[model samples]
Target: MSKRTIDYYTKIGILTPERSESNYRFYGEDSIETLHLVSQCKEQNMPLAEIKEKISLYYTSSVEKEKLLKYAQVLSKRMEHLEAELKEIKPLLDALNEEEQKSIINRMSPQSMALAQSLIILFN
Candidate 1:
């Protein structure tokens, strides 16, 4: 972690550490546990304010299944949007020559191209 992040957490009171004789901050087990929780939340693209609120409310080292499921919904929504976008691109794809179409397909990731192909098949 960067010093800025630690300082931000400390400034926000999300993390509290004790000052030692040399004035170096020392964090206890609770702080360590909170750091782990914060890390997990950050990895899931959670905002710091929401994470702070969740930490304050739950005060746990583990994320609950409900919270995990809620996060997964973001991915579901994103996939739906991608499917719609791919659908719109379908008509434009028909205007391109075979080589141009292949070039466009090559530019896309395999998974994305597969999704486009599946949409084409489904609609046709």
Candidate 2:
């Protein structure tokens, strides 16, 4: 709803709202949906070039349903891998008392924390 939101989408080439006679930008359903998809992909930390390629593939494919199904399959596999890692880690996490958890946090690097967050999100 804000100019910054529109500007971000425009910068990504995900949305191109048309200007009205009064120079107000008007976003249609397609643009809004594209923006939503772009935001979701970004939240997952998917690379922009990969996102662009996927978007183009979605639009240009004659067998869109098949392509979408394939993409879903890939995502499913990723989710499965994440789930397995979480399963392996959950017991260890649960076994740690509060003090241990604090100690682990104190010793963990930022990169390790980020990786853990990414793994959790992927599974989630």
Query: What is the per-residue lDDT of model 2 for residues 5-103, given as tens digits with 9 covering 90 to 100?
Result: 678767777667789999988888877777677777787777776566567665674757776787777677766776797779878987999999889
The best candidate in terms of lDDT: 1
Q: For candidate 1, lDDT tens digit of each residue in 1-124? A: 8888888899998998999999999889988899999998886577787677767656646777776676567557755776787678778988999999889878988776687677667656
* C-alpha RMSD values across all candidates: 6.6, 7.8
- lDDT, candidate 1, equals 0.79
**Regions of candidate 1 where Cα sits further than 4 Å from its true position:** 1-61, 118-124
Error of 1 at 3 (Å): 9.4
Off by over 4 Å in 2: 19-24, 61-84, 87-124
Give the 10-residue window scoring lowest on summed lDDT in candidate 2. Answer: 52-61
For candidate 2, what is the TM-score? 0.46
